[model samples]
Target: MKIFKRTKIKKYSKDGRILFTKEMKKEYTILIPMMLPIHFKFMKNILVKHGYKAELLNTSHSRIIEEGLQNVHNDTCYPALLVIGQLLDAIKSRKYDEDKLALIITQTGGGCRASNYIYLLRKALKKNKLEHIPVISFNLNGMEKNPGFMIRPSLLVQFVYATLYGDILMLLSNQVRPYEINPGETDRIVDKWVIKLSNELNGKSFFSKRNIKRNMEQIAADFAHIPVKKVDKIQVGIVGEIYMKYSPLGKNSLEELLAQEDAEVHIPGLMDFIIYTCDNRITDTKLYGINIIASFLAALLKNYLIRMQNMLIDAVKTQYIFKAPSSFDHIKSLVKGYIGTGVKMGEGWLLTAEMLELINSGIENIICTQPFGCLPNHISGKGMIRKIKERHQNANIVAIDYDSGATKINQENRIKLMLSTARLNLLKAADDSEAFLDNAQTR
Candidate 1:
């Protein structure tokens, strides 16, 4: 028997010099994936306006998957495959000068396979013989320093609005788009406001305490005006790995798939995950002997995020059927008996808390989607399933494993079976309501 020998990955020299040269700055475009389209639009605009070129890579063709399969291993998580694939495929397309190009990928710098995603991407680029293309890690912690790229305070403020606004838009759009009486009206409104809000977020004056609060209120009001029709539809909450939770590419157009199933989708906003990630830093300080400065920043971010979430909720609840997100403290409280907040890896305690949040909110049908071999999801998701189900007997929960090797049909079939159970429960509840009404009328 002959074992295939794997090529040893070469390490890049750590001389603190950026891979992106100053000469390439004028023409170099950094290619990144689209997790939240609206947020990325705002972010891309900010990056470009600051004398850098940033492009959101999304190809609606089958070649996206083909490129992923060709370069990455079958056992890699779905998002990693698609992201690495999207980058490689775009590079091969030769739309830009190979010499003047770079790629930006987010490294959570947490305890997951994702922290090493850059290494895998480097390997893939090497295999494709595009080794000259620089890869940058877009993280707040300065994991990989690049002289060509830096996060300034002004840009950070814009990103704050980008995230808060994106969260507001995402939260409202999910509710509006599915039920809007006028086809495409929801999307039209969302697009219109994203541009309007992006413009409002540009100036220093825009970030003042008064203006930020006003903008959050106004953004909520704008989404509330999207003429939505009240309809009885099965509301399904999608909670899982951060990427799979929101990214269409990662989850195979899951929101659309639910729409086809006549289900109203409820995705916890990206802000929740962002807050969870930030909150983990504070938790990390408690866990290990992490620095006090890191703890202070994390706490500051956690507070700001909580306030922003509440502001959107208050403004939107006046007109729409919007449910404000739970506070970080509340989410942490959720996992006390079932799991610990200490289980902070991958989606960690946040995944369990999200499921519990959805269950409590009457959106009992849930799909906990995770990539195969994702240990954190395995522990926090499937591991806590029994505990969650024991508490909520009517919870129609399904955990779907997404891997490169998993077929769409097979994955969908499992979802269908879960939905079938959900439909039955819905019918039973309707019957019970009708029976009670009939009995009262007879009396």
Candidate 2:
């Protein structure tokens, strides 16, 4: 009888970075940082379906910030601190076996400091004497690689669809939640679809075009049918650093705070950011004569993503009650004169464009959430606010800075002040409408 023996896998790469091998994939649980809760949940499900043990860390304890401050430098951006802290706190919690754990952090591959977060995380791991644990760089631009964690073409497509689904769900639920007659109907619908879609995504026909379209339409219809007492509420749009805008822990539950203040929240979808990143590649080639192949590939990917976005918009349009998201092209066009596309650091001109889109869409009450020490966002976000208001005098924009030192009461108070102005605007508009109706009736 002939027998084959398994060989031991190497633990570290030549560069000294710990490697997550195929053998480890069987036993290790990959912990992902929470960014967009709904989107990440869908993504985590996709990862699980592909035979990987994945867990989304939802722990938002005070120790997370404490851990981040202890390990990461204080001057670094707030998002980085929060993320690193959350991961380290998870490791320290002893909830999972340290030897059987790995981490995944996204790299934008841009000039932004986010690209270096993985290295920072590794350094922190070493400082904490957990250097043996592997960290995976989840990026599109081939920034890093691991045998156990590869994003296959099929997986990438599923991720795209997942974002599309998550965006629509988030958009519809936000619009409905504030107005729904039943307290939690919107959340119930959201929970139901998250499970249903997750199951479908795991199946063989996960990528079926017909099913995707049908599911989107069905989701829109479900939210549309929720009985809402539609009254004029201050429509608030949030645009800022990606993390602060999406992550609840990062923003101190800004969305919930706005809802409590009797405002409807509108946040641009993740796909827009993805598309913006792709568009930046093309922009680089045009302006700086960068690699033609990279630009061409970016253009192709951007077009494909836009096509998917259009399908999502069409699905949302199937229900008239909910306003469909504007096309990314439309958003890009809005920033032509306001900011140059070359300002592609951090959120870049996309931040400026989102504010413009929201203003034009009549969500004039804007909260531009800025993280501490993120210069790019400050430039594109807070810097452009004055220019934006110069054109649209009705624009009510508040730039709130968030960091460990920034108190929630201060942030909420500023938001409250903005809401106060929004309320005055709302009443004035109501009075004007009533007077116009009275004039019409007399005539």
Candidate whose TM-score is highest:
2
Q: What would the per-residue lDDT of candidate 1 be over residues 328-406, giving only the tens digit for each residue?
A: 6776787778887888889899899999989988889999988776888889987888889999999989988876667
Residue pairs clashing in model 1 are none
lDDT at position 177, candidate 2: 95
* lDDT digits (tens) for residues 306-338 of candidate 2: 998999999999988887889999999999889
**Local error of candidate 1 at residue 292 (angstroms):** 3.3
* RMSD of each candidate relative to the true structure: 5.3, 3.1
Candidate 1 lDDT at 354 equals 91
